[model samples]
Target: MTVDEVVSRSDLSISSAHEENLRAGPQASRLGVLRRSFQREVHLDAGHVLAERGEAIEKANLVIDGFLLHTLHDGPKRAIVGVSLPGDIVGLSAFGIGSMGHSVVTAGPASVRQLEFPLFEELSARMPSIVLQMASLEAAVQRQWIANCQRLTAPQHIAHLFCEWRHRLARSNGMKQVVRTPFSQTDLGDMCGISAIHANRAVANLRNAGLAEIRRGDLYTSDWTELEKCARFDPSYLRAVRT
Candidate 1:
């Protein structure tokens, strides 16, 4: 999708995630400047690598319409560390760094607005609030991922992942009972640190409990409150900062 297309989409409240932080008061006008500064829009198919681990960072990408999987590689083994959704920045760490610590690839067909490193640096210098907002978001995402892998049980882990995604989608787009996703059972397992078979069973448990179900490529939840309880989810960490 082009920048104009993304801004015009009624489903998206702003052109970029950072823009959301600057939406109110006088900072609102900076949104237009930020949008125009974006270099270009690039589209990728599923499994396409956006950045390789330890590779020099040339630009940062703002996710426009799909998911990006963040993974860590060690020899032959790999672990899914995080997933970047719509309105999320994929390579913000590149701002003051030369290389990405992990590999990032498209989980499905996705589009991103590329901000060249020099331009990103310039923007960051001019608008310190953007850096602050991005840093806050990055920290929250990391803390949530750590909790998901360490504290939650298999079923709870899976449920929490769904709940988090649902909350995030609601923020970027709009709230809905059914969340459209591109992640498969294997992908879900990777995110939750479980095998595909274990992930299947966990999903079954959620379905049996009338909490949630992953059918096809969508997550259907009947009872939001119950599902939140099942996942032990607290949405505060994922809440947008309104000023």
Candidate 2:
């Protein structure tokens, strides 16, 4: 789908005017001006393919904001990885090896810092932080994959996801911060390894139970305690480590 469609379908609240300023400023990476010689930024729409199936690998993205999904297409089945929230890096392994595997697509309208693979490799030679962060992120992704492989039903998986989200947001200071969440039931369901109907039902159940409020392409937690119980989530997985 096009970026426009993602914008239309999502209830994301981004300032176009400020975004323009950031894009045009000397500090902005997209402009390639001062203070931004190494980093590049890209805005992706929901369902937009960051990299299509079997596409050449050129860059690995660090998610500065929004959500994304990694999917594998095996003839008739499409298996989706869970949501890649902010602070969660994507395409690490593929980029590390200098090749691409599967398709990395946007879960919704997302803002990302796109570091060229060559540049990343070059920087890693000098900056240890990049390598460390990539390693940590890769480990996280591996764990998620293992977890999904032995996962329960979709609803149960989603419950786990919700719990994880809470922990993630809390660790990132995102839970208490005021920012728009850009996820729909369809997208959430896709990440949870469940059907869209089931995903919607799960969200409705959360809302009716007064733990979260899911509406108009927005997902917000109203009662963290209740939400935690619904998902039976533990916060340990969301811990942040210095890289």
Candidate 3:
């Protein structure tokens, strides 16, 4: 559906986490001002490409639900640079840019609000704090991508990915430890830069170790401490500005 159509729809969903952030902060009034101009929410089916690489990112997106995988292509080689969870803003880097550096595709059935660049600029003009938050978020995402691509081993990457999701989902969903992930083994592989078969093996290993288990389309960790140790996870990359 078109942006205008989605905006007009009364049933359009908003990310509760995002709304809370905007409404609870010191810059609440400024954020609220910008939020009022937010565009309509759009729903995407799994595997749908929300924006393609090399195309100009006319708008930035606020994810309301599900995950978005950012994939970068180098000739025939494809690498997943990042995953956008609910309450995360995708394409912030493309703001004031020429084109998208990577293609964003839905990891599952997803919902997002598309904020056009012009409106984003307006938001920034009204409240620079929001822009700072976006910048901080983008930096955090890039740091994680660097670690996943260059520092972590295959198994460590998978474990770290899950741990990161747990923390993110917790912050967004009443600070819960269990994360509801709808991704398949292939999606896990993409995020971890491993093969689907390898992802399955890694998961099996984790399950055997009593660190994690996937049940009913959700991922639950029996012992987060052990899981973090197994992943060698460091939480510094996911921190946002406290203000």
Tens-place lDDT per residue, model 3, 1-243, is 433443333123445544575568757544544444456689899999988988887877888889888898778666777888877777777766767888999887999987777656655665677778767866786777676668877666777887888877765586667778777887777777788898888888878878788664467876788878988887777665531
Task: Name the top lDDT candidate.
Answer: 1
Compared with the true structure, the alpha-carbon lDDT of candidate 3 equals: 0.73
| lDDT score of residue 32 within candidate 3 | 44
- Among the numbered candidates, top TM-score falls to 1
Compared to the true structure, candidate 3 yields what TM-score? 0.81
lDDT string for model 2 (11-71, tens) is 2333453366466652232221111222467778777888776676776677776767777
**True-structure Cα RMSD, model 1:** 5.1
lDDT by residue for model 1 (1-243), tens:
443443345225445644554565445445445544554789999999999989998887878889899998668666899888877776776656788988999988999988776656666677678666766877787888887788888889988888888888885688888888888888888888778899899889988888888896688877888988988999888755421
- Model 3 RMSD to the real structure? 4.6
lDDT per model vs. reference: 0.76, 0.58, 0.73
- What is the full ranking by TM-score, best candidate first? 1, 3, 2
C-alpha TM-scores of all predictions? 0.86, 0.68, 0.81
* CA deviation > 4 Å runs, candidate 1: 1-23, 27-32, 240-243
Model 3 residue 90 CA deviation (Å) reads 2.0
